[model samples]
Target: MSALWDLPDYDDHEVVHFVRDHASGLSAIIALHSTHLGPAAGGTRFWHYADKTNAVKDVLRLSRGMSYKNAMAGLPMGGGKAVILADEDRTKTPAMLAAFGDAVERLGGRYVTAEDVGISVADMQAVAERTSFVSGLPAEGDNAGGDPGPFTAFGIFLGIQAAAKFKLGRDSMDGVHVAIQGTGSVGGRLARLLAKDGAKLTLADIDADGANDLASELGAEIVSTDEIMQVECDVFSPNALGGVLDDASIAALRSPIVAGGANNQLARPEHGKLLAQREILYAPDYVINAGGIISVASEYFAKTENREVDVAEVRERIAEIPGRLVSIWEEAASSGRTSAEIADARAQELIGRG
Candidate 1:
């Protein structure tokens, strides 16, 4: 097993906590990558992992990405992330969630938890039941806002448009072929948005039933996961797992642009350079998928003022994603650097000022 402290870029992390509750069968890790701007805030992800090392590494990388994501989104919060290692079907229970919430509360307000991947609004509500360090609750009374998935999908759609304009020199997604991997919450919403805009869709997901249903609803063609990346399309949108843009996968991609909701999409830092070398316009994942965090931050800020979240304001903030991507794309072209590197540098500068 690799030592957590020895991992590359491990020094960049501000704090890390390992929480275990044997009674509830809960084992989790929370990583706070930075708190220069404000308290660390990000989502809690629950997924079964093959080993503890991989889980810890994921939280570390994701938390760091959150730092960049938050900075680029212009949120005052820093970056932190939590991961619960357990089978969603068998080990997830109210007791487990509450235990996890207790762990979050122990961090004080330095870290806030929300919905991500294996976690949902309902699950966040369960976490909220145990502590105040949670968001994404239903809009019941003065509760913190609801799901941010749709907003995230909308942001990605807008970012894709910016990439298309930068690469294809067009302003519309009309008639553009897009292969989307993962038809879950965010991806599903994104597909609907793209289809409504008259974009051709090829959908893929591990959940065959759900993907097929979405495909039928949107008049899209369904492809297996293995074939999704190789599909002939103008854009390859990965809405599922991270590290899908590794050397092997990058070699097989036929798209001229890659933009989607997956965080930490590059397997390694060098992958960004490879994408740039290949002339594939890549929209940095953190910049594109920041709508969710933006929504969460809005709720957090509203709570400070003792008011309900302003959904309209949140939408307006998310609408800035495309413009931000355009700026980053232009800067990368002028600097002859990967978009990811440029984004990281800008984020670092922002964090430095804080």
Candidate 2:
């Protein structure tokens, strides 16, 4: 493994922590990318990384993305992320969660954690047992706690609409062919939304059964995971992991528009330029995937203020995603830059002002 300080993207971050709890076998990394806006707040991703180096790199990138995402979404929170390097299937335990919670508590509010990939609200609840720096709990009374999947999908749906409008010269998704490369929580809900709008759907996932089930429900054609990216479609939505838009896939992609709920869709920054060169309208992933963070921010605000959560306000904020996308699209078109570059510049300006 490369030296932590020598890793790419390490210089800009404020702090990075590696935690180990021998008794509980909990090993994790938490990265705080920025605190110019406020205390860092992002999700706790639990994945069985091949090694500690991969976990560290993933947290660093994800934390940085959260910073930009929060800035672009007009939120007060800064960016941070946590990743536990253990198999969620067999290694997760209550003791392990409490130990992870203790590690978060040590940060003393510098970083707040929520649920991400391989993590659930129940897991957040377990983390909360040891520290108050947690969000995404199950709803009770007026508290808004639950999965952010649907909200995220809603944002992607809005982003897809904006892309459709820009590329197809129409505001509706009617009869538009969209190839979704993951049918998990976010993708499944997104497919339902698109289906309601009369879009033709092509679905694929690593989990064949889940993908097939969703496809049957939505009348979407099921494609193998490998073929989904190269499929003929008007839009290609990636709801799976990152690095799917790397050199090979970008060269093979046939879609006119690329938008999705996944974070870090572009394998490298230059891939954004490549997509632009190919005449693909690319929605910045951080900008499009801000829906979950918006909901989490609202819940955090309500908790801090000791007030009832405002569901309407959350919906209103999410509804603005399309307009934001349109503005970014216009700016990219006028400036002759990729949308990712434009969004990153805008986010940096916001961070600087903070």
- Per TM-score, the best of the predicted structures is 2
Collision pairs in model 2: none
- In angstroms, how far off is 270's CA in candidate 2? 0.5
lDDT of each: 0.90, 0.89
Give one digit per residue, the lDDT tens place, for model 1 in 1-101: 66778897474698999999989989899999999988899999989887767788789989999998998899999999999998646468899999999
The C-alpha local distance difference test score for the whole of candidate 2 amounts to 0.89
Q: RMSD (Cα, Å) of candidate 1?
A: 1.7
Q: Per-residue lDDT of 35-66 in model 2, one digit per residue for the tens?
A: 88888999998898866677887998899999
Give me the candidate number with maximum lDDT: 1
lDDT of 1: 0.90
TM-scores of the candidates are 0.96, 0.97
